[model samples]
Target: MKQKMLAKAVGIALVMAPLASQAAVENIQYFGYAKWGNIYTDNDDHNNGKGERNDVIRASEGYGNYRLGNELNWWEAGLKADVWQDGDAYFDTTLYLGSGESWGDVSIIQMWSAGHGLFASQPNAKVWAGERFYRRHEVHMIDIKYWDTSSTGIGIEDWDLGFGSGHIAWMAPNSSADGRSLHNIDARISDIAISDTADLTFGLNYIFTQNSSYEESDITTSGAMLSALYRQAWDYGSNTFAFQYGTNALAGGLMSAEGGSNRKYSTGVEHDGYSWRVFNSGDLNVNEDFQVMYSIAYQDKNLDNNDGEKWFSVGARPQYSWTDYMATALEVGYETVEAQNGAGTNDMYKVTVAQMFQAGKGVWARPSLRIFATYSEKNDEWNRGGDTYGTAMRNASGKDSVDEVTFGFNVETWW
Candidate 1:
């Protein structure tokens, strides 16, 4: 208990340390997020919860994006700086290194490479996968990333891209049983073009990995992903229209554990005045014997099979702004995933809603409140020819699917 409290204190101190610089710089700006929340998992044991529990508060700074340094000149020079939380662990630093350029703006330190996926995908649908209380997970490792934006010349704005290489380990210690240590490297490019009604963006990434546990020890595996997005604001008097599409693919060794090649496609559309959006994601397992090896124990297992699973999801999200400081949002989604090999199949349904309010610019320094809820179900069936298998997998923690209500306050600023 004392150790946890001490860690919290240290975190608070580190965050405040940057505030001291605010007094000296004329053009410096500071901003961040701080909140206290709890977790009540239906499957308490799923995320190493000893038992039913209540955590007082968990403070998070910037979600995962970190801003480290400031540029004095538009495209002449600047330094690298950032201090943000990765899950529960915080990385604090303001180092001026790796200086360069692509189009116009000066480059600081390389944070993201071109070889890794660019988009920010959500975690698993499970809460346990969504929350990280005390562990520092999802740390970013960049081999080298530099950017430039002067290529567009005066009046026209260009984009900045980066290239990097490094290995991806799930956590700090790399403890997964089926963990693969590879000499993988990826690159990324973003902020392409800023036009009146249209913008273009693209990214490509590749990963090469190896599993030492295999009999051959030299299992060279590789995968790549490409993404392109374009959004235009259409003027229809009181309303507007926008659309987006993205696709990803994984081949080679990554397909070994899951069976075959892995591919996913997603697209979304929204309107200007209307606070509603429609989107869909489709996943396809190209191999018949690809299985994902997961465990409640966090242990690795042999995940080879004679069948595969393919699923698709469709959802709608609508939000309304009651006042400049108050709003309400609702979401409904349905997804179905199935494996064919005479083994079994699983299907799921989900619905969620949230009402949020703010006192001062969405900050709790004065105080704000948000209410949210979600309900989900998973039905499983196993039938091999005329033979019937065991029952489906269910939440063993004794609670139905899972339910919870989160209430919290945030205190921070950005400039």
Candidate 2:
């Protein structure tokens, strides 16, 4: 499907090339990203083999965009697709055509709800998620949205406010959200805005979601959410300050023994041009089962700044370019996942270093050498033990996480 789609797009571009030279023609663009690397982990317990074929090395993504009449007076459309070696695929596209004038830009298009964009922004970057493995796809279905911007009259340094409303596939219900079905139908309006400041910035997002999570019985759930973020860069002092707060309604499994909201707050800073960065996510639960991470890089330019496809979640990485096609990075991180309310606390530590090299162009080939090691203070951190106390996390497929080395290469390409 992806190859055929790309070929069709190219064929159209070729046919339109001559037309573009004479008359108005839609401009089409194509791009893709690919990465592959060897991965290894050691747990000291050889239940799983070391130097195993790292399955994390195969992934590809591509996107296409077309614009009519060149500028802001016409129509636009975009399509994106991603496929992983592990047999996972994602397809998303949008088409909008409208004109901009005194009434603010208006367009009718199938796109992500304002709420969806806000909620997804919580993740730090493109690559990293809370866990090592990708979560099941949970996103809204197709919906029509009305967007309007150009309304604020703040000044030279004015703020930009955008609003959109539409129906979408809600992720709160279904077996994925626990065995509860709230008969939730997607119908919601979301508003979002970004404030501009010479040295500071802030963003606000609000969503009016309906027919939220459900329960086996007649338990009804519906509500709203508000998220705000602020950041300031102290260029003279070479420092930065940031803070974020968000409140979300809870139902079904997320509902605590006592009804309350599921909220999160975080703050952190960095200096010396991002040689260091720190961030932490905290939960509203009294137990405060949160995750904290701090990372420091040895390179001058943060690897993240140079990364074409930012892949880590905890934060950006700094890479050393050995050559145009090769680079290496050393990363070490410590994470704290507080034991459950009744369970004692357990801490886990991990350290990884990898050297990656790339070859080819379209589907550039990549290979890397990596060493990953993880250990828990209480052995039960990742459920090393069986169903004992619900603490162990087992990977019978791979060896332990204490000390292991992986060596492999992944070849991938995109249109």
Output the number of the lDDT-best candidate.
1
Q: Assess each prediction's global lDDT (C-alpha) against the native.
A: 0.27, 0.24
Question: Candidate 1 versus the native: TM-score?
Answer: 0.43
Instruction: Put down candidate 2 lDDT per residue, 1-415, tens digits, no spaces.
Output: 6676567557556643443353322233343322223333343233356534322110011000000000012223332222212212222222222323212333332222111112232221122111110111110000000011111111111112234222223232322222333222222222322323223333332222233333333222232222122232232212223222222221111111110011100001010011111222211111112112222111111211121111111222234555556555443333232222222223223334445554421111233322232222212222324321122333344322232343333333233
- Counting clashing residue pairs in each candidate, in order, gives 23, 18
The lDDT, on a scale of 0 to 1, for candidate 1 is 0.27
**When superposed on Cα atoms, how far off is each prediction in RMSD?**
17.6, 18.4
Candidate 2: count the clashes.
18
